[model samples]
Target chain A: MTVQDSLLAPDLPFPIFQISQTVRRYLLYDINTVTWLRRTHNILGVFIGSLPQSPQQNVFFGLPMELQPEEATLLVEKGLAFIADDFRTHKQAVRSPPRAMANYKATARKEALATAKAVTKQKQLKTQEVLQRLNVRQGTPDADNTVDNDEPDESIFDTSTQETSSRPVSSSVIPYSSTPTTSYPPIPTPSKQSSLPLPEVSASSYALFKHLHALGYFMSPGLRFGCQFSVYPGDPLRFHSHFLAMGHDWDEEIDILDLIGGGRLGTGVKKGWLIGGAVKNSDDNEKHVATSEDGQSEIGRKPGDFHVRTFCVEWSGM
Target chain B: MGDLQPSALTAYIEASRPVGVLPQDSHHHALAAQVLHNLQYQHDWTDLRIHTDSSHSARPLLKPLVSGLPPHRIYVHPDEQIEMLKQSVQEKDVPSEREWVLPTHLRETWSLRKFAELFDGIDPVPPAENQASEEKPPFPTAKGGIGSRRGGKRLMLATVGDDSTVVYYVVHDGIVKPRQN
Candidate 1:
């Protein structure tokens, strides 16, 4: 395959795990794979995980990245990704050897101990420097050497001293017996037989997403913007979204007031309001239903089965 | 009937007489009253009441919240739905729970802190009324009364636009499993 073909359909497809069935949440947890998806396939999922650096603050988030159903469906259709039921995989992991779990705990405890020791050493050094400065100010620099010699070795491991320090140790530094909720042990790749069928999205919305994606626009969920999807000309990290897109069926009624509201809102934010849908006649609709009834998955259907038409609306000063 | 008269809405708001609301924040009570009126009349919700004090802290809430029973259940947690399906429970057979409604203007800007504060003030389920003897149990007893464990604390965020159109979105206290489309 040429480079362009590889971009559309990679030889080794990535796995998108279906964590929840009801809400149809597809998440990709591996950061390296997330970067690869963006660079190679132009797929940009939202990071919905809390940041470890500042878990209390909501301004910045971390992984696992959440993919729109349309994005997951498109990736599966293109032979670039597959969906697996993570809950099933998790159940399987629970049945694995207890020795593996013990090993994981041991490693975590060792890491935590090292971190705590490092923090204590750093604090002790800071305290020694402060004492030396005070000795110099008193014109008794010799006392600094005595103070250093008098430093108690037991104080390094003393819990009371650490607790009485001006800066209390953060909870993150203390090792707890319970495993962290966020971390998971590595599991074997799920077999093809265990892979789930791609998620089902509204036909019109999928068509609109595929059309915009084909034209090189990256999209993200537009719930924050009060729209279906936010369209970006380049990677969202490097560029602002250019449009707030809404999809409809070809014969669906268009509310003029809703259109005006969308246009005005989009213009106020320097974005255009985009509306689009797949044009399907009655015959095509019947054929689609017939094919589904014949036990053919949506992936077996062709993208060229319908043509999508899109229009961009912006408020005019006049 | 004709469009609801502004004078009637004003009279209803006055009659509600929401207490413990600060003078400057009286507009919030009016907003909650407007939503309560809509829920009771337009939506056919029953057992409607406006709350000015926090159920947990007993302190005045950031704003008034309207609690009522809708004609039908507005939301069913995905996990709860699966459990009900396994038990072969009919959709109509599942008793409806009272919903907490947070009323606000569409033009208002909301932040995560504001939402967090609101969620902190309320209980997972709104308190049941003492006078309603005819009301059915909130949940079937066979399921061990899964009250709020499966579906965390949530509220109906009612944002009223300038056109008097109230749009509601389910706002949960924390991450809840997504429901299938």
Candidate 2:
């Protein structure tokens, strides 16, 4: 791909993978790839992982560069990079290993305990029936064996019903399989389990990023510059950053000190400070359902493309 | 779940070799690690070298000195700032420049005396861009360009907050003329 091409080279888009949590990594093939990113795009992600630099070993593991979720998500949406599995998709997939493992382990433990309890109770009842049948057979010397088998099954069904009634609703639906739970460790409810449900920082930050990228402004996490994002009016190599952008939500309260601090920093760097939030529409139910998927589609279109309203804050020093 | 990171900042520092023997104190090392991490990633610095040997002077630095070359020049000497200002007035584009970055954390406060000591050890301009930078004074006492850069022996003060927000301020060793608005 021609590096000098004015339009973004669609072919050169990097591949970003969400490794764990806030960390995401991009596998870079060579040192020159880093040099190109550093000098051209102004994409200054850190080298979080590397192999020993030696010529003797033909196996040179590519350098792994790291960026925050805010940075990673933007790179993907802008078509500057494509993620392995979008964070949003991975997040909602209950099958993802980490959370799934924990959830499964706890569920398996609870089911096992309930099954053990029911099995012991059922076995005791079985022994009692067997003993009574033995006594009856001894007394009658010819009680029909088929009738005895039939009688015990009805009683076994009654005992199973009792077990179902006593066990938790989660464990009671399947009747016949007394399958032992796998040897999975017990998992406590995750920290997020009890917290109120809301699309968090990742979602909102992504919303802001999507809005800006659509506007054609290249942006990166403002962490280095003390804001939520830094908006570049043009390719970073050609122009200084134009704005220090901060993102919040409609209902979230912002600190005045933050405004003043952001404004002062903007003034110092000769850039405008932008504070923004995703506009809350009147339809609460639609928004509630769309919150997660809202990031992907623009069909839930409000009056304007700017679902987020950004206002400039420039400090006027007295 | 999104916020948690194995936090490879420390290990990255070790691999980058910002310097060996980071700090005896865990807190100091951690603070140094954070700044170095940001410098490498956020600022796009290369060849980061950390200094923990307090043996540079009497009264060891409150923390370590992190030096690296930012992808772009971050500071302007008084003379260079003046040259750029003059060029801009003359209708010419000011040339791009690069500076060696001295990374610092946000929580640490510094007095003038402390700053002067830091000024003592390092060159006013980083050694990386020596061809264009060598002639410039290591530290100039004159007033700098109009509200552009701080004067005197200056260093880029990179203060990283707990939320990983880093703000850079150009600090001078002593008073200089405040630029006219």
Candidate 3:
């Protein structure tokens, strides 16, 4: 569902609105789609940080969708989209399992527990046999051995924790949560989504987004052309996208494959692949961060302190 | 339940790993599942179906492809647009309504031949609701020789980025006339 549909939901737990950024006159607060959609009134903003995938997908491919910065700013004025916390990042705090995720954990935990008990029992038997070979006497007799067999050593689970730390085990009360074979991070026992708010835009992308927004280009997600944003001269339906734009940090090195692949995709589709970055204003580098704290509105927008530079990549068929 | 979570499809996938129900190739299933989720929720798409194995040829699709009925018009058929133009309707856009979703991963590379195989296996429209269950998706109606949008080809390539963002672009087999803006 779009962010607008989510805000209509009445049962959302309290979501703390974190200040993410500010561009021009707009206040870019970070809210998940639910709040961003409903609270923000679908006014426009790129809903970033998580795509709707199943718990099964989370357990397997946990890739989350990021919001294009231009879309984020674009949505605020229109009240259609919202900058949601990256679901992938907050999933580290997966509190609620819903039905499916709970089921996976229930089954996986049971499987792990059963396996844990069986393996421990075998170790007990082997240890007992070793005593027999050495002619050792048991003070507690078979009764003690049977009792030990009845209770699986909980310590085995502690060792399992060392091997797989991603599991969000609420407590040791639930057994077999640390299943080594199970690739899923321990589903926090409850199925509730995280209530924490977050900042959606990265520094460099936000800078580029602000730069492009100032230049008056309609920007949307450009994953279609393997770029960060797709620049449009007008509303997307009215015109084909003009450029596949991407933003990077000043010192970051881009891979050659990205250059070739991006160039090819752009040329094939007849669009330019635009790359850009925020170059720190060397004259006043230290004061830039200090100046970003202008007000309660922007905690992001550090790009203002640096000059933004960009260029279009067109494939030259020599 | 999706209030604080991501999309409804996410809830659906997390619901269970029904034994023998989901397709193999964890990544393929992941890509298809993402597209299916986006269709069902993001764009109000319905009647979704998935195809992992191919019936037309010996080779299965590199990944599963999807087909569904879009809530809004996706593409404007050229002939239909011409008819609309003749009537002089201000809004020439009409939903193509039904189409196929070609699920792809960004990390993977695509050559012309690979795209040809995909086009060769697909149809002008999505599978019918009834027959959809009887067979896997990707029922090619008429032969669409691949080029650009050249031969009136239609396939929405749903490419999934590592970040879980699935951006869809209308990919035609060959270069077709530029639609009247």
- Individual DockQ of the candidates? 0.01, 0.02, 0.01
lDDT of 2 at A41: 52
Docking band of candidate 1? incorrect
For residues B109-135, write the lDDT of model 2, one tens digit per residue: 433224434555555444442355334
User: Largest TM-score belongs to which candidate?
Assistant: 1
All candidates: TM-score: 0.49, 0.32, 0.32
Per-model C-alpha lDDT, please?
Answer: 0.70, 0.52, 0.52
Q: Alpha-carbon error at B45 in model 3, in Å?
A: 0.4
Cα lDDT tens digits, model 3, B96-136, are: 34667777777665543345456556555555668644343
Which residue segments of model 3 deviate by more than 4 Å?
A: A1-318, B1-11, B16-18, B21-24, B77-82, B89-95, B131-151
For residues B8-121, write the lDDT of model 1, one tens digit per residue: 778998987656526328788889999998888888888888877788785667778899888776776666777778877776776667888888787675443355456667
Candidate 2 per-residue C-alpha lDDT over A1-318 given as tens digits, one digit per residue, 9 for 90 to 100: 464643433244544544434433334323454556554555555564434466454332345555555555545544465554334433544444686677765676677667766776676576667756765665475566545554554465567654554454444344443344322133221222222211124555666766666656767668778887788866766877777777666556554445557767776787766655565653532432354222445565555444554455443221
Compose the digit string of candidate 1's lDDT tens values, residues A1-318: 477645554235767899887878999877767777788678988888985667686756778888999999988888778898899977887776888878877887887677776776687677767655655665465555555543543354456555535465554466544445555564555555688987989987898898778767899999988899999878998988878888877767565455557766876787767777775554534433454322334454465655455555454321
Where does the lowest 10-residue lDDT sum fall in candidate 1 chain B?
Answer: B172-181
